[model samples]
Target chain A: MPNLYQEVIFWALFAITVFSALLVVGQRDMFRSALALIVTFLAIAGIFAQMNAEFLAVAQVLIYVGAVSVLVIFAVMFTKDMPHSTRSTNLQPVSIVVVGLLFIALSWAIFQSQWNEMPAELPVFVESTLVDSSSQLGTAIIRDYVMAFETVGVLLLAAVVGALALVRDK
Target chain B: MLERYLLLSVILFCIGLYGALSRRNIIAVLICTELMLNGVNVALVAFSRYSTPAFMRLTSVDASDSVKVLDGQAFAIFVVVVAAAEVALGLALVIALIRSRNTTDVTEINLMGN
Candidate 1:
């Protein structure tokens, strides 16, 4: 069983994440939606920490909050216009029904499934003082997942080039 | 605890789905997609923490005998990398769309659909 502080913090982060994610989807102002997205990302990072993924939590803050949200806010600024109350499509009702159904089915599956979980006493990487989690992650990337690592690097380079090409003046 | 995290993931994913399907603004669509990715990331990390075995450090005469598995977190890192690259390119495309069409509304920019 998790400690009391862990449960409290987890619930708090969960509420914040869900609320801000809703704001991101529902806000009328695009700028405010982007801001709410930032909040959602931050809260998710906190949840990552609760899951004992400190490295992922840091990367979440740096990549999602730092880079992605900043880029999105810049896009919002570039496309700013007169505020409109309506941002939803004519398909809003249909989308709501579909998403609601999806949510129900997923939650049902989650509750019904029997996952093969590790023993409760198994130490999470960050909690184990004997080994460095980040270093282990790095070694796995270089040694075990070197092909995937190189592929991701190439993918990023291609994305960068493609984006520049797309945005350059005609 | 696993169920709680999974439930949270589904909720966020569903909300993002609704937004992506219903939002008229293209940037809003992009933002919703990011939310979906984050939802997946949460599930990934939760499983990583709860489902996977603990880190085992084996010592042999050759140090290369040691084995470490952080597969879920590594996959999550790749997901983050892909998401970052995708968002960069996506925002660039949004900017270019704004430059050419002068509007960010997806409904108004349906030039390709017959």
Candidate 2:
């Protein structure tokens, strides 16, 4: 039942995301790795679009591909010494084993779990509402989740202050 | 559909985890963390889109509909906001590390007063 268009896009996004993530880990140059990270983020955003989460896709592009990628590039700019020290032991074999184990465990859980069809009286298929998520999201932030919303604002404020204090001359 | 999305999310998370753990550079680690967070966001949004109750879907016409739960989008927004803050603070720390040691290796900066 898979449409060719969706399948094509999904597989393309998946390939780019995984490949760029590998680039992020394997590239000797930190700047090139940072650029690869941007590709990964953008591909993930495309996946978000394929999922029909329009608002989230936009936010992913704006916040992640735009802001976070820029911040990471600046960090890479500051830390240019990573490429020089090509230590033989820079890679960890244990991490690969651990990640493989985690992937197996997660796949098992995903298959065994009944998340797609919960026992509760949930819809068989959630109607994709790509048109109204932004309005709905804005409303949720203001009405039901207002307290958490304010807390996030305060957290950002504190983060700014903390960053300044950390960088200040001692 | 849900399974496909979840599978991608899980794989993305594992890749990010490996990158964070195996890579020596702190910046690579940071990028990996961002990738992991994006994976989590994907899962959250997928759940939100796929898990709505039938009654909520039918009855929720207005933006103020309490029956409808846009919790996933809300959580994703919070994650994005917090991640921005985290990157800001994290880069500052990275800069400090660079200034102090002139290096970006995670193994070199031991603050244990050795």
Best by DockQ: 1
DockQ, each predicted model: 0.61, 0.53
Error of 2 at A107 (Å): 0.8
Model 2: per-residue Cα lDDT over A50-139, one tens digit each: 766677789888988889888888777766544446442345788888899999999999888876443343332223234566776787
Candidate closest to the true structure, highest TM-score: 1
Clashes of 2: 0
Please list the residue runs of candidate 1 whose C-alpha ends up more than 4 Å from where it truly belongs after superposition.
Answer: A82-85, A123-131, B53-69
Cα lDDT over the full model 2? 0.78
RMSD after Cα superposition, model 2? 3.5
**lDDT digits (tens) for residues A40-103 of candidate 1:** 9999999987776778889999998999988998888877772333757989999989998899
Model 1 chain A scores worst on lDDT over the 10 consecutive residues at: A123-132
Given candidate 2, what's the lDDT at residue A118? 30
lDDT scores of the candidates, listed in order: 0.83, 0.78
